[model samples]
Target chain A: MGQYKITLSGEAQTAIVRHGEQAFPFECCGFLYGHENDGRFVTEAMPVANNKKGDRRKQFEISPPDYMKAEKYALGNGLQLLGAYHSHPNHPAIASAHDLALAMPYFSYVIVSVKNGKAADIKSWRLKETIEKKFAEEKVAVKHMAMFSD
Target chain B: MAKIIIPTPLRKFTANTATFETSGSNIKEAIQELTGAYNGLTRHLLDNDFNIRSFIKIYLGEDDINSLQKEDTTIANDSVISIVPIIAGGC
Candidate 1:
C-alpha cells in the first residue's frame, strides 16, 4: 500500500534455494507468509507442489486447495499469507507476461533463478497497478527470525 | 445468514471490509446476496453470464463448493464461507 519492502527469513531463504535445487529441470513454486512491521514485511516460505501438470520446467500451477492448505497452516502459526514464490529454471529471476496475468493486487512475488539444478539468484516483485502492465522490483532482505521450531 | 470471508484483492469494492454476511439457503444465493449488497463487486465476482468467476474459489468451512454441492452447496446459520482467488500463476 505504501513504500514497503520484503524481508525473507534465513530459513525461508534456505528453503527457497533447497526447493529450487530439488526441483531442478522443472519449475518449483510455493507461498510466503508473514506480518508487516513498520511498513516493511517479513515472510517465510511455504513450499507447495508445483503441480503445473505439463512442461514442469516452464510453468507451475498451485491449485486453490493448495492455497487453502497454506492459509490454514499460516493461521496455525500466527502468520498471514503475504505473497507467493516460484522458480524459473534455466531462466533469470524475472516475472513473465503470464505471471503478471495470474497476479492479484497487494501480494509480493518472489522468483528464484535456478541453473543446472542449482539456485542462482532470487528476486521479489509486486504488481504496481490495479491493471498492471508490469512488475516492479522490491527489496528482499534476509533476516534471522527467532521463533519456535518449524 | 452466513458469513462470507472476503480476501484482500476484492476488498476495495467492499470499502475494504475483510468480511461480511449474506442471507441465502445455499452458496449461490449467498454469493448473489453478497453481490446485491455490494454494488461495485458484481463485476469482479461474476462473469457476463453471471456465473461465479472460475478463478474464485468458494469453500464452506473445510469443503470446497465444487466437491460439495457446487452452487447448490448448503449453508447453515453458522457456515463460514471463504471466497479466495486462486493464486497460481506462471509460465
Candidate 2:
C-alpha cells in the first residue's frame, strides 16, 4: 500500500464486484465518480460497455463518447471523475503492462480479479509521474454502511 | 474565446488550471493557443505529426471531433471543448 488510497462506498464496491461476476471470463470496465479530499472517495461505480474490437477476453476498451458521458454524469451529480475500475477474468488484481501503457497520471485504476465467475481479490493502483511510468499500489478502503429499515 | 476543459490528469502541465480560455476560432487553433500557453502539454495532447493523439479524444460540446471536421471544426466563442483520453487496458 502506498500513500495514495481510495475509499469505495459499500454500494460502489458491490457494483464493481457484481459487474465482474456478470461479465465473467471477459473483462468489464466502468467509471468511478467521487470527490478527492485527502484521498479519493468513490461514491458511485457506473458500468460502461466494453467497446474493445477484438479479443474481448483479455482486453477492454471504453469509447470516447462513453467517457464523455461518464464525465458529464459526474459533473451533473456534483462529483468529479476520480478514476476507473476494471475486472481481470481469471487473473490477479494487479496492474499489467498494457494497463501501464494506457494509464494516465492522477487517476486511480482499480483492478478486480474474477476467478471462475466469482469476484476475488480487488486492488487499486496509480500511475507514477515519472519518465518510466509504473503503477504504485494504492490502499483500498471499503466504507461499510449499516442498512436501516424504514 | 472558446473554453477548453482540461481533464484532471493533464492539469499538472497547466499549473493545475482546470479550464483554459483561448482565442483560437477552430479546434486546432484553440489547441495551438493552449499548447503555446503551456508548452508541457504539447507532447501529451499531440503526436509527432502535430495531430491529436489517437488515444486522446477532443470533443466540441457533446459531439466528438472525429464525427465532425476533426481539428478543423469551427468553434463558437461560447463553445465548450473537452479533451478526453481513451481508457483501455488488458490482462
Candidate 3:
C-alpha cells in the first residue's frame, strides 16, 4: 500500500460538494487543477452528469469535444490534468472496487461520500503496487496508504 | 476464484450485477473469461491487442494494474478487481 495527498482550495471543495448534491441519484465528476509544483487544487470545470447509469455514485467523464477543449486549455496554459473528483452518495468515502481497478498511476482520485443523505465524508487515494508513495492533502507527507495528488 | 466488480457504467454489459466471480490464474485470463461471457464488452474494455482502453482504468486493491503487472497481474481467490472509467465534466 502507498499514501497520497490531494490538496485543493476551499472553493473547490464547496463546488464539489454542491455538484454532488445536485446529482443525487447519479454520480457527478469533474477535474481539479493547480500549479505543477504547487499543492492546492482548484476546481476548474463544471460538473457533468453520468449518462450511463442512474446510480448515486457520480462518474465523471469528459466527452470527445470537451476533451479537445480541455486539451487546448491545458496546452495554452501549460497545465496538465492533476486528477479527478467524484461523489459516492449514501456510501462510504473510500475507493470502491471499481475505483481501484481503473486507477491511473500519476493521477489522484478524490471521493466524497455522503452520509445520512448528506455529503459528510471526503477521502483521497493513489494506487501503488509495492512502492511507498506520498499524497498531498494540505501539505506533503508519506505514511501508510496515504493518498497524493488532487 | 477472483471477483470482478463492474462499474455502474459497465453494468449494462453485465446484466446489472455489481460483482462477478470466476476462476482464473491472472488478471488477463479473468478479464478474458468475463468478456467472453459478456459479449460486446470486450471492445469496450480492451483493444484488439488486449491493451486496456485509454478511457478505462483498472485496479487491484490499492494498486493499479498499469503500475503492478498489467494483465499478467495475478488474481487470487481473495482478490477484488475494480473497473472505473474516466469521467469528464464541470459544474
Highest lDDT among the candidates is held by which one? 2
Off by over 4 Å in 2: A145-150
Error of 2 at A114 (Å): 0.3
lDDT of 3 by residue, A1-150 (tens): 344455556666667777776776556776665544545355453464454443334454544334334434655676555567787877776676566655545566677775545677677665553333333332223223223222
Model 3, residue B90: distance off in Å is 17
Candidate 1 — which pairs collide?
A: none
Chain A superposition TM-score per model = 0.88, 0.94, 0.71
User: For residues A1-150, what per-residue lDDT tens digits would candidate 1 score against the true structure?
Assistant: 234478888888888888988988888898888886575455578788887768888998888778767767766888777788899999998888878877766678888888888787888888775443467888777787432223
Worst 10 residues of 2 chain A by lDDT: A141-150
lDDT of each: 0.80, 0.89, 0.62
Q: Which consecutive 10 residues in model 2 chain B have the weakest lDDT in total? A: B1-10
lDDT at A121 for candidate 1? 81
**In DockQ terms, which candidate is top?**
2
What DockQ results do all the predictions give, each relative to the true complex?
Answer: 0.53, 0.70, 0.08
Residue A108 C-alpha lDDT in model 2: 89
Per-residue lDDT, model 3, residue B73, is 92
Q: Could you tell which candidate, 1 or 2, scores higher by lDDT?
A: 2
Cα displacement (Å) at residue A10, model 3: 1.2
Best first by TM-score, ranked: 2, 1, 3
**lDDT per residue, candidate 2, A1-150, as tens digits?**
667888999899889998998998889999999998777899999999999999888999999889878867876889988889999999999999999888988888999999999887889999777767788999988898532111
Report the lDDT tens digits of candidate 2 across residue range B15-81: 9898999889899999999999999899889989999987899999889998999999999999999
